[model samples]
Target: MRLLTQLVWVFTVLAILLAVVLLFTYDVIKVEWISFMEIQPSHRQMEDPLPVPARSIPIEGPVSIPGMLPPENPVEADEASIARGSELFEIHCRMCHGQTAEGNGPIAPFLANKPANLTSPIVQSKSDGSIFLTITNGVEGKMPPLNENLLVHDRWDLVNFIRTLTIED
Candidate 1:
Protein backbone atom coordinates (compact mmCIF):
# COMPACT_ATOMS: atom_id res chain seq x y z
CA MET A 1 0.00 0.00 0.00
CA ARG A 2 2.92 2.44 0.74
CA LEU A 3 4.68 1.52 -2.49
CA LEU A 4 1.47 2.18 -4.47
CA THR A 5 1.20 5.69 -2.90
CA GLN A 6 4.86 6.46 -3.76
CA LEU A 7 4.28 5.49 -7.49
CA VAL A 8 1.19 7.74 -7.61
CA TRP A 9 3.22 10.69 -6.19
CA VAL A 10 6.04 10.13 -8.75
CA PHE A 11 3.53 10.07 -11.64
CA THR A 12 1.86 13.25 -10.34
CA VAL A 13 5.24 15.11 -10.22
CA LEU A 14 6.10 13.97 -13.78
CA ALA A 15 2.68 15.20 -15.10
CA ILE A 16 3.17 18.62 -13.42
CA LEU A 17 6.68 19.00 -14.92
CA LEU A 18 5.44 18.10 -18.44
CA ALA A 19 2.53 20.55 -18.17
CA VAL A 20 4.87 23.39 -17.08
CA VAL A 21 7.30 22.74 -19.96
CA LEU A 22 4.43 22.68 -22.52
CA LEU A 23 2.98 25.94 -21.19
CA PHE A 24 6.36 27.74 -21.53
CA THR A 25 7.19 26.22 -24.98
CA TYR A 26 3.84 26.15 -26.79
CA ASP A 27 2.91 29.04 -29.24
CA VAL A 28 6.44 30.52 -28.79
CA ILE A 29 7.01 33.78 -30.76
CA LYS A 30 10.35 34.09 -32.67
CA VAL A 31 12.26 37.35 -33.42
CA GLU A 32 14.47 37.36 -36.57
CA TRP A 33 15.86 40.81 -37.59
CA ILE A 34 17.51 43.23 -35.15
CA SER A 35 17.42 46.96 -36.02
CA PHE A 36 20.95 48.43 -35.77
CA MET A 37 21.55 51.53 -33.61
CA GLU A 38 24.58 52.52 -35.75
CA ILE A 39 25.21 52.34 -39.54
CA GLN A 40 28.64 51.77 -41.20
CA PRO A 41 29.54 53.14 -44.69
CA SER A 42 31.19 50.87 -47.32
CA HIS A 43 34.77 51.43 -48.58
CA ARG A 44 33.65 53.22 -51.75
CA GLN A 45 31.25 55.48 -49.89
CA MET A 46 33.86 56.36 -47.26
CA GLU A 47 36.45 57.35 -49.91
CA ASP A 48 36.83 60.76 -51.64
CA PRO A 49 33.59 62.29 -52.95
CA LEU A 50 35.41 64.52 -55.59
CA PRO A 51 35.54 63.11 -59.15
CA VAL A 52 39.01 62.82 -60.84
CA PRO A 53 39.42 64.85 -64.03
CA ALA A 54 39.57 62.94 -67.34
CA ARG A 55 42.84 62.92 -69.36
CA SER A 56 43.42 62.20 -73.08
CA ILE A 57 45.22 58.97 -74.09
CA PRO A 58 47.70 59.74 -76.91
CA ILE A 59 47.94 57.35 -79.90
CA GLU A 60 51.51 56.45 -80.92
CA GLY A 61 50.98 53.83 -83.64
CA PRO A 62 48.17 52.40 -85.78
CA VAL A 63 45.05 52.10 -83.67
CA SER A 64 43.69 48.65 -83.03
CA ILE A 65 40.02 47.75 -82.71
CA PRO A 66 38.22 48.92 -79.58
CA GLY A 67 36.35 45.66 -79.10
CA MET A 68 35.83 43.99 -82.49
CA LEU A 69 38.86 44.31 -84.78
CA PRO A 70 38.55 46.29 -88.02
CA PRO A 71 39.17 44.56 -91.42
CA GLU A 72 42.77 43.99 -92.55
CA ASN A 73 44.15 46.12 -95.37
CA PRO A 74 43.64 44.50 -98.82
CA VAL A 75 47.07 43.76 -100.29
CA GLU A 76 48.07 42.97 -103.89
CA ALA A 77 47.96 39.34 -105.08
CA ASP A 78 51.65 38.81 -104.29
CA GLU A 79 53.14 35.58 -102.99
CA ALA A 80 54.16 36.98 -99.55
CA SER A 81 50.89 38.70 -98.55
CA ILE A 82 48.89 35.71 -99.77
CA ALA A 83 51.16 33.41 -97.75
CA ARG A 84 50.69 35.54 -94.62
CA GLY A 85 46.93 35.65 -95.13
CA SER A 86 46.97 31.89 -95.74
CA GLU A 87 48.68 31.37 -92.41
CA LEU A 88 46.18 33.57 -90.61
CA PHE A 89 43.28 31.85 -92.37
CA GLU A 90 44.61 28.44 -91.41
CA ILE A 91 44.84 29.44 -87.77
CA HIS A 92 41.54 31.31 -87.42
CA CYS A 93 39.25 30.23 -90.27
CA ARG A 94 40.41 26.82 -91.59
CA MET A 95 38.62 24.91 -88.82
CA CYS A 96 35.32 26.02 -90.31
CA HIS A 97 36.17 27.02 -93.92
CA GLY A 98 38.67 24.21 -94.73
CA GLN A 99 42.40 24.19 -95.56
CA THR A 100 41.76 24.74 -99.30
CA ALA A 101 38.67 26.92 -98.88
CA GLU A 102 36.63 23.99 -100.25
CA GLY A 103 33.82 24.19 -97.65
CA ASN A 104 35.00 20.92 -96.16
CA GLY A 105 36.60 21.00 -92.74
CA PRO A 106 36.34 18.60 -89.79
CA ILE A 107 33.51 20.74 -88.40
CA ALA A 108 31.89 21.17 -91.85
CA PRO A 109 29.94 17.91 -91.62
CA PHE A 110 28.54 18.79 -88.19
CA LEU A 111 27.55 22.38 -89.00
CA ALA A 112 23.85 22.87 -89.86
CA ASN A 113 25.05 25.41 -92.48
CA LYS A 114 28.08 24.34 -94.47
CA PRO A 115 31.01 26.70 -95.00
CA ALA A 116 31.23 28.70 -98.28
CA ASN A 117 33.57 27.66 -101.10
CA LEU A 118 35.99 30.53 -101.60
CA THR A 119 37.32 29.21 -104.94
CA SER A 120 33.92 29.19 -106.68
CA PRO A 121 33.66 31.58 -109.61
CA ILE A 122 30.33 32.67 -108.22
CA VAL A 123 32.05 33.63 -105.00
CA GLN A 124 34.77 35.34 -107.04
CA SER A 125 32.18 37.36 -108.93
CA LYS A 126 30.92 38.92 -105.71
CA SER A 127 32.37 42.43 -104.96
CA ASP A 128 35.17 42.69 -102.42
CA GLY A 129 32.93 44.96 -100.34
CA SER A 130 30.29 42.25 -100.28
CA ILE A 131 32.81 39.69 -99.14
CA PHE A 132 34.23 42.06 -96.55
CA LEU A 133 30.73 42.84 -95.27
CA THR A 134 29.95 39.14 -95.01
CA ILE A 135 33.18 38.55 -93.14
CA THR A 136 32.44 41.42 -90.76
CA ASN A 137 28.78 40.68 -90.20
CA GLY A 138 28.30 36.96 -90.69
CA VAL A 139 25.14 35.49 -92.22
CA GLU A 140 22.49 34.70 -89.64
CA GLY A 141 22.33 30.96 -88.79
CA LYS A 142 25.35 30.40 -91.05
CA MET A 143 28.58 32.03 -89.81
CA PRO A 144 29.82 33.75 -86.69
CA PRO A 145 31.19 37.33 -86.71
CA LEU A 146 34.92 37.53 -87.50
CA ASN A 147 35.02 41.17 -86.38
CA GLU A 148 35.58 40.00 -82.84
CA ASN A 149 38.55 37.86 -83.86
CA LEU A 150 40.01 39.45 -87.03
CA LEU A 151 40.81 43.09 -87.77
CA VAL A 152 39.35 45.02 -90.75
CA HIS A 153 42.72 44.91 -92.57
CA ASP A 154 42.98 41.17 -91.95
CA ARG A 155 39.55 40.57 -93.48
CA TRP A 156 40.61 42.39 -96.64
CA ASP A 157 43.81 40.35 -96.71
CA LEU A 158 41.61 37.24 -96.45
CA VAL A 159 39.56 38.50 -99.38
CA ASN A 160 42.71 39.02 -101.45
CA PHE A 161 43.83 35.55 -100.46
CA ILE A 162 40.46 34.08 -101.55
CA ARG A 163 40.73 35.83 -104.92
CA THR A 164 44.13 34.24 -105.42
CA LEU A 165 42.58 30.79 -104.92
CA THR A 166 40.32 31.27 -107.98
CA ILE A 167 42.47 33.32 -110.36
CA GLU A 168 45.15 31.73 -112.55
CA ASP A 169 48.81 32.68 -111.83
Candidate 2:
Protein backbone atom coordinates (compact mmCIF):
# COMPACT_ATOMS: atom_id res chain seq x y z
CA MET A 1 0.00 0.00 0.00
CA ARG A 2 2.77 2.42 0.87
CA LEU A 3 4.57 1.71 -2.39
CA LEU A 4 1.34 2.16 -4.38
CA THR A 5 0.67 5.54 -2.73
CA GLN A 6 4.20 6.72 -3.52
CA LEU A 7 3.84 5.64 -7.19
CA VAL A 8 0.51 7.46 -7.47
CA TRP A 9 2.02 10.70 -6.00
CA VAL A 10 5.02 10.48 -8.34
CA PHE A 11 2.82 9.93 -11.39
CA THR A 12 0.56 12.87 -10.37
CA VAL A 13 3.57 15.18 -9.94
CA LEU A 14 5.01 14.12 -13.28
CA ALA A 15 1.69 14.69 -15.06
CA ILE A 16 1.29 18.17 -13.52
CA LEU A 17 4.87 19.11 -14.44
CA LEU A 18 4.34 17.98 -18.01
CA ALA A 19 1.16 19.98 -18.23
CA VAL A 20 2.91 23.08 -16.84
CA VAL A 21 5.78 22.74 -19.31
CA LEU A 22 3.36 22.43 -22.24
CA LEU A 23 1.37 25.48 -21.07
CA PHE A 24 4.55 27.50 -20.71
CA THR A 25 5.82 26.36 -24.08
CA TYR A 26 2.60 27.31 -25.82
CA ASP A 27 1.70 30.52 -23.96
CA VAL A 28 5.01 32.05 -22.90
CA ILE A 29 7.79 30.46 -24.98
CA LYS A 30 5.80 30.55 -28.27
CA VAL A 31 8.00 27.98 -29.96
CA GLU A 32 7.33 27.88 -33.74
CA TRP A 33 8.24 24.30 -34.50
CA ILE A 34 6.76 24.49 -38.01
CA SER A 35 6.53 27.92 -39.64
CA PHE A 36 4.21 27.07 -42.51
CA MET A 37 2.12 30.23 -41.89
CA GLU A 38 4.76 32.89 -41.24
CA ILE A 39 4.34 36.55 -42.32
CA GLN A 40 6.60 36.46 -45.40
CA PRO A 41 5.61 38.48 -48.46
CA SER A 42 4.25 36.58 -51.46
CA HIS A 43 4.47 37.21 -55.22
CA ARG A 44 1.34 39.41 -55.14
CA GLN A 45 2.98 41.92 -52.81
CA MET A 46 2.87 45.60 -53.92
CA GLU A 47 6.01 46.71 -52.12
CA ASP A 48 7.01 49.45 -54.57
CA PRO A 49 4.33 51.08 -56.74
CA LEU A 50 5.48 52.78 -59.94
CA PRO A 51 5.14 56.55 -59.96
CA VAL A 52 3.15 58.18 -62.79
CA PRO A 53 5.02 60.58 -65.09
CA ALA A 54 4.38 64.30 -64.56
CA ARG A 55 1.27 65.55 -66.47
CA SER A 56 0.26 61.97 -67.26
CA ILE A 57 -3.41 61.58 -68.11
CA PRO A 58 -5.45 59.48 -65.68
CA ILE A 59 -6.36 56.00 -66.84
CA GLU A 60 -10.03 56.71 -66.02
CA GLY A 61 -9.82 59.82 -68.23
CA PRO A 62 -9.59 63.48 -67.18
CA VAL A 63 -10.55 64.19 -63.58
CA SER A 64 -12.04 67.63 -63.11
CA ILE A 65 -9.91 69.89 -60.97
CA PRO A 66 -11.98 71.05 -57.99
CA GLY A 67 -13.01 74.77 -57.91
CA MET A 68 -13.09 74.80 -61.69
CA LEU A 69 -16.49 74.90 -63.38
CA PRO A 70 -17.90 71.49 -62.41
CA PRO A 71 -17.02 68.98 -65.12
CA GLU A 72 -19.75 68.57 -67.73
CA ASN A 73 -22.33 65.89 -66.88
CA PRO A 74 -21.35 63.12 -69.29
CA VAL A 75 -24.10 60.75 -68.13
CA GLU A 76 -27.40 61.84 -69.59
CA ALA A 77 -30.43 61.92 -67.25
CA ASP A 78 -32.44 59.64 -69.55
CA GLU A 79 -34.95 57.13 -68.15
CA ALA A 80 -32.45 54.28 -68.05
CA SER A 81 -29.74 56.38 -66.40
CA ILE A 82 -32.22 57.80 -63.86
CA ALA A 83 -33.42 54.28 -63.00
CA ARG A 84 -29.88 53.06 -62.41
CA GLY A 85 -29.10 56.16 -60.38
CA SER A 86 -32.21 55.65 -58.28
CA GLU A 87 -31.14 52.10 -57.49
CA LEU A 88 -27.61 53.14 -56.52
CA PHE A 89 -28.92 56.01 -54.43
CA GLU A 90 -31.20 53.69 -52.48
CA ILE A 91 -28.41 51.27 -51.75
CA HIS A 92 -25.78 53.86 -50.70
CA CYS A 93 -27.49 57.15 -50.06
CA ARG A 94 -30.85 56.18 -48.54
CA MET A 95 -29.29 55.01 -45.28
CA CYS A 96 -28.20 58.60 -44.60
CA HIS A 97 -30.20 60.76 -46.98
CA GLY A 98 -33.57 58.96 -46.48
CA GLN A 99 -35.98 57.51 -49.04
CA THR A 100 -37.26 60.99 -49.92
CA ALA A 101 -33.77 62.53 -49.79
CA GLU A 102 -34.93 64.85 -46.98
CA GLY A 103 -32.00 64.09 -44.62
CA ASN A 104 -34.28 62.11 -42.32
CA GLY A 105 -32.94 58.60 -42.81
CA PRO A 106 -33.25 56.18 -39.89
CA ILE A 107 -29.53 56.55 -39.14
CA ALA A 108 -29.51 60.33 -39.63
CA PRO A 109 -30.35 61.06 -35.99
CA PHE A 110 -27.41 58.97 -34.78
CA LEU A 111 -24.87 60.81 -36.96
CA ALA A 112 -22.75 63.68 -35.56
CA ASN A 113 -23.83 65.93 -38.44
CA LYS A 114 -27.24 65.72 -40.05
CA PRO A 115 -27.24 64.90 -43.75
CA ALA A 116 -28.07 67.73 -46.12
CA ASN A 117 -31.58 67.86 -47.58
CA LEU A 118 -31.16 66.75 -51.17
CA THR A 119 -34.38 68.39 -52.34
CA SER A 120 -33.64 71.77 -50.77
CA PRO A 121 -32.97 74.72 -53.06
CA ILE A 122 -29.42 75.18 -51.77
CA VAL A 123 -28.55 71.68 -52.90
CA GLN A 124 -30.71 71.66 -56.03
CA SER A 125 -29.36 74.99 -57.24
CA LYS A 126 -25.79 73.67 -57.46
CA SER A 127 -24.54 72.50 -60.86
CA ASP A 128 -24.61 68.76 -61.56
CA GLY A 129 -20.78 68.64 -61.53
CA SER A 130 -20.76 70.28 -58.09
CA ILE A 131 -23.09 67.56 -56.83
CA PHE A 132 -20.90 64.94 -58.44
CA LEU A 133 -17.82 66.39 -56.71
CA THR A 134 -19.64 66.44 -53.37
CA ILE A 135 -20.50 62.78 -53.79
CA THR A 136 -16.92 61.97 -54.83
CA ASN A 137 -15.03 64.00 -52.17
CA GLY A 138 -17.72 64.31 -49.45
CA VAL A 139 -18.26 67.22 -47.06
CA GLU A 140 -15.75 67.33 -44.19
CA GLY A 141 -17.21 66.15 -40.85
CA LYS A 142 -20.65 65.85 -42.46
CA MET A 143 -20.40 63.24 -45.23
CA PRO A 144 -18.03 60.44 -46.10
CA PRO A 145 -16.24 60.28 -49.48
CA LEU A 146 -18.05 57.79 -51.68
CA ASN A 147 -15.36 57.76 -54.36
CA GLU A 148 -13.96 54.51 -53.05
CA ASN A 149 -17.35 52.84 -52.78
CA LEU A 150 -18.81 54.27 -56.01
CA LEU A 151 -17.48 54.29 -59.55
CA VAL A 152 -17.30 57.56 -61.50
CA HIS A 153 -20.35 56.57 -63.57
CA ASP A 154 -22.20 55.64 -60.40
CA ARG A 155 -21.47 59.08 -58.95
CA TRP A 156 -22.81 60.67 -62.13
CA ASP A 157 -25.90 58.50 -61.85
CA LEU A 158 -26.34 59.66 -58.25
CA VAL A 159 -26.20 63.25 -59.49
CA ASN A 160 -28.93 62.46 -61.99
CA PHE A 161 -31.08 60.84 -59.30
CA ILE A 162 -30.62 63.90 -57.06
CA ARG A 163 -31.98 66.05 -59.88
CA THR A 164 -35.20 64.02 -59.91
CA LEU A 165 -35.59 64.74 -56.20
CA THR A 166 -35.61 68.51 -56.88
CA ILE A 167 -38.12 68.06 -59.70
CA GLU A 168 -40.48 66.27 -57.31
CA ASP A 169 -40.37 69.13 -54.74
Candidate 3:
Protein backbone atom coordinates (compact mmCIF):
# COMPACT_ATOMS: atom_id res chain seq x y z
CA MET A 1 0.00 0.00 0.00
CA ARG A 2 2.90 2.41 0.85
CA LEU A 3 4.65 1.58 -2.48
CA LEU A 4 1.45 2.30 -4.36
CA THR A 5 1.14 5.78 -2.72
CA GLN A 6 4.85 6.52 -3.38
CA LEU A 7 4.46 5.55 -7.07
CA VAL A 8 1.37 7.77 -7.38
CA TRP A 9 3.25 10.74 -5.82
CA VAL A 10 6.26 10.23 -8.16
CA PHE A 11 4.05 10.18 -11.24
CA THR A 12 2.20 13.33 -10.09
CA VAL A 13 5.52 15.17 -9.54
CA LEU A 14 6.84 14.09 -12.96
CA ALA A 15 3.64 15.21 -14.66
CA ILE A 16 3.91 18.65 -13.02
CA LEU A 17 7.57 19.02 -14.11
CA LEU A 18 6.71 17.95 -17.67
CA ALA A 19 4.00 20.61 -17.78
CA VAL A 20 6.52 23.27 -16.68
CA VAL A 21 8.92 22.28 -19.50
CA LEU A 22 6.10 22.26 -22.03
CA LEU A 23 4.94 25.74 -20.90
CA PHE A 24 8.31 27.28 -21.78
CA THR A 25 8.74 25.34 -25.04
CA TYR A 26 5.22 26.22 -26.19
CA ASP A 27 5.38 29.79 -24.92
CA VAL A 28 1.83 30.62 -25.90
CA ILE A 29 0.34 28.05 -23.54
CA LYS A 30 -1.91 29.36 -20.76
CA VAL A 31 -1.74 32.83 -22.32
CA GLU A 32 -5.44 33.34 -21.70
CA TRP A 33 -4.93 32.74 -18.00
CA ILE A 34 -2.03 35.18 -17.97
CA SER A 35 -3.67 38.12 -19.78
CA PHE A 36 -6.78 38.87 -21.83
CA MET A 37 -4.67 40.77 -24.35
CA GLU A 38 -3.04 37.61 -25.69
CA ILE A 39 -6.39 36.42 -27.03
CA GLN A 40 -7.67 39.78 -28.38
CA PRO A 41 -7.42 40.88 -32.03
CA SER A 42 -4.30 42.93 -32.69
CA HIS A 43 -2.51 44.47 -35.64
CA ARG A 44 1.01 43.44 -36.57
CA GLN A 45 3.64 45.98 -37.48
CA MET A 46 3.44 47.04 -41.16
CA GLU A 47 0.10 45.30 -41.47
CA ASP A 48 -2.12 46.72 -44.18
CA PRO A 49 -4.89 48.63 -42.45
CA LEU A 50 -8.56 48.03 -43.08
CA PRO A 51 -9.88 49.82 -46.15
CA VAL A 52 -11.93 52.96 -45.68
CA PRO A 53 -15.70 52.51 -45.84
CA ALA A 54 -17.18 53.46 -49.23
CA ARG A 55 -18.21 57.09 -49.89
CA SER A 56 -16.71 58.26 -46.60
CA ILE A 57 -15.21 61.73 -46.76
CA PRO A 58 -12.19 62.51 -44.60
CA ILE A 59 -12.64 64.60 -41.49
CA GLU A 60 -11.12 67.61 -43.28
CA GLY A 61 -13.55 67.09 -46.23
CA PRO A 62 -13.57 65.43 -49.62
CA VAL A 63 -10.28 65.81 -51.45
CA SER A 64 -11.69 64.26 -54.59
CA ILE A 65 -14.60 62.03 -55.45
CA PRO A 66 -14.18 58.54 -56.90
CA GLY A 67 -14.50 58.03 -60.70
CA MET A 68 -13.98 61.78 -61.10
CA LEU A 69 -11.46 63.59 -63.27
CA PRO A 70 -8.43 64.87 -61.39
CA PRO A 71 -9.64 67.84 -59.38
CA GLU A 72 -8.40 71.32 -60.29
CA ASN A 73 -5.80 73.08 -58.15
CA PRO A 74 -8.02 75.14 -55.90
CA VAL A 75 -5.17 76.68 -53.93
CA GLU A 76 -3.66 79.66 -55.72
CA ALA A 77 0.12 79.80 -56.06
CA ASP A 78 0.63 82.94 -54.01
CA GLU A 79 3.97 83.83 -52.39
CA ALA A 80 2.86 82.32 -49.12
CA SER A 81 1.57 79.20 -50.81
CA ILE A 82 4.81 78.72 -52.73
CA ALA A 83 6.81 79.32 -49.56
CA ARG A 84 4.76 76.76 -47.69
CA GLY A 85 5.17 74.37 -50.56
CA SER A 86 8.93 74.81 -50.45
CA GLU A 87 8.93 73.94 -46.78
CA LEU A 88 6.73 70.92 -47.40
CA PHE A 89 8.96 69.77 -50.25
CA GLU A 90 12.02 70.00 -48.07
CA ILE A 91 10.29 68.01 -45.36
CA HIS A 92 8.61 65.45 -47.58
CA CYS A 93 10.45 65.41 -50.92
CA ARG A 94 14.03 66.58 -50.45
CA MET A 95 15.17 63.13 -49.35
CA CYS A 96 14.33 61.73 -52.80
CA HIS A 97 13.80 64.76 -55.12
CA GLY A 98 16.83 66.69 -53.82
CA GLN A 99 17.54 70.27 -52.72
CA THR A 100 17.36 71.50 -56.34
CA ALA A 101 14.39 69.32 -57.27
CA GLU A 102 16.78 67.68 -59.74
CA GLY A 103 16.27 64.06 -58.66
CA ASN A 104 19.56 63.97 -56.81
CA GLY A 105 18.33 64.02 -53.24
CA PRO A 106 20.46 62.19 -50.66
CA ILE A 107 18.48 58.96 -50.97
CA ALA A 108 18.06 59.11 -54.74
CA PRO A 109 21.05 56.88 -55.51
CA PHE A 110 19.85 54.26 -53.07
CA LEU A 111 16.46 53.92 -54.76
CA ALA A 112 16.04 51.33 -57.56
CA ASN A 113 14.05 53.84 -59.64
CA LYS A 114 15.55 57.32 -59.75
CA PRO A 115 13.32 60.11 -58.59
CA ALA A 116 11.90 62.36 -61.34
CA ASN A 117 13.47 65.77 -61.87
CA LEU A 118 10.91 68.43 -61.04
CA THR A 119 12.94 71.00 -62.99
CA SER A 120 12.67 68.91 -66.18
CA PRO A 121 10.19 69.95 -68.84
CA ILE A 122 8.39 66.61 -68.55
CA VAL A 123 7.30 67.48 -65.05
CA GLN A 124 6.93 71.21 -65.72
CA SER A 125 4.55 70.65 -68.63
CA LYS A 126 2.14 68.56 -66.59
CA SER A 127 -0.99 70.46 -65.56
CA ASP A 128 -1.20 71.64 -61.94
CA GLY A 129 -4.17 69.30 -61.50
CA SER A 130 -2.11 66.44 -62.91
CA ILE A 131 0.74 67.19 -60.56
CA PHE A 132 -1.72 67.24 -57.68
CA LEU A 133 -2.99 63.80 -58.70
CA THR A 134 0.52 62.42 -58.86
CA ILE A 135 1.14 63.68 -55.38
CA THR A 136 -2.16 62.17 -54.28
CA ASN A 137 -1.91 58.77 -55.96
CA GLY A 138 1.87 58.49 -56.33
CA VAL A 139 3.74 56.60 -59.06
CA GLU A 140 3.05 52.88 -58.92
CA GLY A 141 5.90 51.01 -57.18
CA LYS A 142 8.00 54.16 -57.21
CA MET A 143 6.61 56.87 -54.96
CA PRO A 144 4.31 56.27 -52.03
CA PRO A 145 1.06 58.26 -51.91
CA LEU A 146 1.23 61.54 -50.01
CA ASN A 147 -2.52 62.00 -49.85
CA GLU A 148 -2.50 60.82 -46.25
CA ASN A 149 0.53 62.91 -45.31
CA LEU A 150 -0.47 66.31 -46.73
CA LEU A 151 -3.70 68.23 -46.67
CA VAL A 152 -5.31 69.39 -49.91
CA HIS A 153 -3.93 72.90 -49.55
CA ASP A 154 -0.47 71.61 -48.74
CA ARG A 155 -0.38 69.45 -51.91
CA TRP A 156 -1.37 72.44 -54.06
CA ASP A 157 1.42 74.41 -52.42
CA LEU A 158 3.88 71.65 -53.25
CA VAL A 159 2.69 71.73 -56.88
CA ASN A 160 3.23 75.49 -57.00
CA PHE A 161 6.71 75.06 -55.62
CA ILE A 162 7.44 72.49 -58.33
CA ARG A 163 6.59 75.14 -60.92
CA THR A 164 9.28 77.43 -59.51
CA LEU A 165 11.91 74.76 -60.22
CA THR A 166 12.01 76.06 -63.85
CA ILE A 167 14.10 79.15 -62.99
CA GLU A 168 17.88 78.85 -63.68
CA ASP A 169 19.46 76.97 -60.77
Assess candidate 3 and give its TM-score to the true structure.
Answer: 0.70
lDDT of 2 by residue, 1-169 (tens): 9999999999999999999899877787666676766655444455543555778765677658746787989988999889999999899999999999999998999999999999998899999988998998799888988876788888898888889985445
What's the lDDT for all of these models? 0.71, 0.85, 0.88
The whole-model C-alpha lDDT of candidate 2 against the native structure comes to 0.85
What is the descending TM-score order? Answer: 3, 2, 1
How do the residues 11-100 of candidate 3 rate in per-residue lDDT, one tens digit apiece?
999999998989977984654456757776666878875677887887867877778877788888899999999999999999999999
Each model's TM-score?
Answer: 0.54, 0.66, 0.70
Question: Which wins on lDDT, candidate 1 or candidate 3?
Answer: 3
TM-score, predicted candidate 1 vs. hidden true structure: 0.54
**Residue pairs with backbone overlap in model 1:** 70-151, 70-152, 71-151, 71-152, 71-153, 72-152, 72-153, 72-154, 72-155, 73-153
Give the best candidate by lDDT. 3
The true-versus-predicted C-alpha distance at residue 161 of model 1, in Å, is 0.4
Looking at model 1, residue 48 earns an lDDT score of 49
Question: Could you give the C-alpha RMSD of every candidate to the true structure, in order shown?
Answer: 13.7, 6.8, 4.2
lDDT of 1 by residue, 1-169 (tens): 9999999999999999988777666735343446574344424655644432455332322323446555344456677767777887898789888988888877999999999887777778887767777887788889986765677667777777877786322
